[model samples]
Target chain A: MNAQYRHSQPGYLMILIGVILLVVAAFVWVYGLQPLEIILGAIGIFLLAFGYKLTVEIKNGFLRFWFGLGIFWKKIAIEQIVYCEPFRGVFAGWGIRFVWNGWLYNVSGMKAVTVVLKSGKKIHIGTDEPVQLIEAINSVLHGQVGVESTQMWSEVKADYLKRVEQALSVARHPRSFEILADVGNHLDRRFTELEPRQQTWENFQRIITEMGPPSEYAELVNEDKKSGRLKLTKLEMSAIGVLLVVFGVSAYFYPQMPERIVTQWGFHGQPSSYMPKPVGMFGTPVIFAVLVIALIVIPRTASVSVNIEGFRRFYGGLLIVFSIVMLAVQYQIILWNLGIKTNPNVVGIISVSAIIVWMAFRFYRARRHN
Target chain B: MNLENWQTQLRKGLLDIVVLNLLNRGPSHGYEMVQTMKRIDGLAIREGNIYPVLARLQTDGLVTSYSEPSTDGPPRKYFKLTEAGQKALEDMNKHWDQLISSLESIRKGTGL
Candidate 1:
């Protein structure tokens, strides 16, 4: 079937001027009046040729719309269109405009029908009889040609799928992947059932939001993996018990020892008067136990995602260093009790310096990695 | 929250029944049907919007299309209601009347 609708008339002023110029040119040519009339006639011909308004027609389910005797034209299948409504965005003002909504083809009047393709782009066709033009388009779309609009729907579906894929690219959590997959399926199922009004930008925005932010989702899903219970190996647990028992049994000698005992020594390898007997004997073991407990508890509570292995290594190093320091203190105290002269200043300085250097190296390496 | 949005939604839902009812009258082309629909006040439908509803109706075997000659242009395609279309129109009209009556009663604070 074929139907035609001419929305705009030809430019009357230009046509009239062209005809006058042609008549004047002919008169001059016949009577040998003036050569300038030839130039005037040529100008009129050019204006008349280009100044006519555009026309639109529907033939065989396709819309054939053109301007000024088909100088500029386009043929669109009506079935690919989703909606056709009257548009009056007058400020867009005239021929072949690219407005924010979409493309506009017009001549003079604000009368136009905006057809939204299934791909979500729009085309505004200027028409004096917008209603009639729309009716014709609707009829073609409802007929056998209507099936082709599914192509447009598929294009829209592809765009949404692409967005979902991008969101999944940075996704860290398996849960986020699952959520996005579900959203993709849901969008596919609901899309065909939606009316034109319901298929707005807001709907897509909502869907994206429902998928959640990729970065935040990743952080949340991996949060639980950051921590685990602080369990010690069987051998390590037995060693801890033995160390604590040995220190406890030695504590019983504090009452029998002299009131004053050497606890610290100066630079020279000579015994130095130190603290009260109890201070030298008990303080070292108490400090060691407290440090060990604090280290174990602190690492266990922290999120494992923020370098759990690093924390474990650091804690183990500190435990070994403190244990060695406690052993030196115990040996010194026992030697003093046996009437031996000894100074721990050299050993103390070396161990402390070694621990400081090791800690500094760990921090420097971490900084480099970051 | 726009009331116009809700109105459009309502119109979209009723469009199928309305198109079938129009075809029940006589065989007419798409443009003619749109023009007739335009006569009703506050019923804003464009010629382009009517096709999908008609296409859907035709798919359901309630309507069919044929070409007809026009006075001043190419032959226009016209839609005719099928046997199923007539039956659907009847049922739709009965349901529409019941709905309208029920809504009217609700508005008047009477029983449905």
Candidate 2:
């Protein structure tokens, strides 16, 4: 097939290196006769066969590339591409290998055109003509060619599109119009594919039935956008309140505490570790504060996508349980410091067992829901 | 739950993988995907429900869409699976196979 654009970059340096390696391997085999010659010869042959050149072509709505006579080839659809831009990165020395979040096809030089796909993966095609390659990709992305927008629809198709719009109206999403257009395009295509006799209102209704209820579309959009923003729920507020209460209790007992306070206990109800009064009394609260901040910030700043809203309740409950556990520990410490006998080991065991059981139950519930 | 409700829940969970498997054959438009899904006896899905699933898939970067001019009507939006989508489908299929085999063993009163 004729491509809209094509470019090839020769790997002169790679060929030179391969030849040198082959010559060295031959010398080693002839003189020293070491088994290491086999490894060197194999690598040399592999490089010469697959690293001689990189060819990139954009044709039939696909970005196709191959290295060294198409032994290793990859094809990406134009529709899958989000955007293409010039890549200016340090010379990492590549020969069809993976980069950060995608693959890099290069024969020589650091200059390349990176195409970011809708899947968030990227393809870096090393090319001497980066500008031309980018232009070719951008033209297709902007719908300048290959794919054209449709302006007209039949009356029957229009009604179907309107119903889809009406159904999706409940979503109130910013991308509603775009989604409507997508559905309209789909209906138009389906209408055209059906036999002329089967293009009646009855057939259209049947098609819509197969599509599912209109409200389902709204639900999907709403669910997909549920994690668009992070907000503190009532449970989270309560968890924070519990943490503050724990801190307040610690403060109440701070003056009565001894300079050295037991912070950790052994399995036999004996104190195993001790800390200064202030550190032992206030350390747990400070750590809890940091943990809370992290819980709030991580979902927002983490590089990977996560649906925090899906388990918002679980997270809030976890925080509350953790705070309560800390509070119990603080109470035990205060009592022990006040000359009241208490088994620190029992408290630790009970707290840990409760947490494990709660977590197991939560996981079971989550599995059932899924 | 009633059998119908149980079946509905099953279909909802399976919808994503089912659509991914269909697209694995080739790129197809929304209507074509819905129609093809209807061919499965117990897996008949509503036509409108497919769009939202497609929308979610596209948002997740698992699937992508492009428009093509049609001779009989307006342009058609066709969806194709991305590499990530293909990988996800493989994993889902593997899990599904394991689930089926485990269930079979349970029914036969073996592999307890």
Best by DockQ: 2
Compute the lDDT of residue A287 as modeled in candidate 2: 85
Off by over 4 Å in 1: A1-227, A233-249, A252-256, A303-307, A360-364, A367-370, B1-112
Question: Which candidate has the top score in lDDT?
Answer: 2
DockQ score for model 2, please? 0.20
Give a tens-digit lDDT track for model 1, residues A103-207. Answer: 667665567877765543457777768778876777667644433343344445445544543443443222232233233333443454455556565664554
lDDT: worst 10-residue window of model 2 chain A: A145-154
Model 2 interface RMSD over true interface Cα atoms = 8.5
Where is model 2 more than 4 Å wrong at Cα? A1-175, A189-210, A226-370
- Cα deviation in Å at residue A168, candidate 2? 3.3
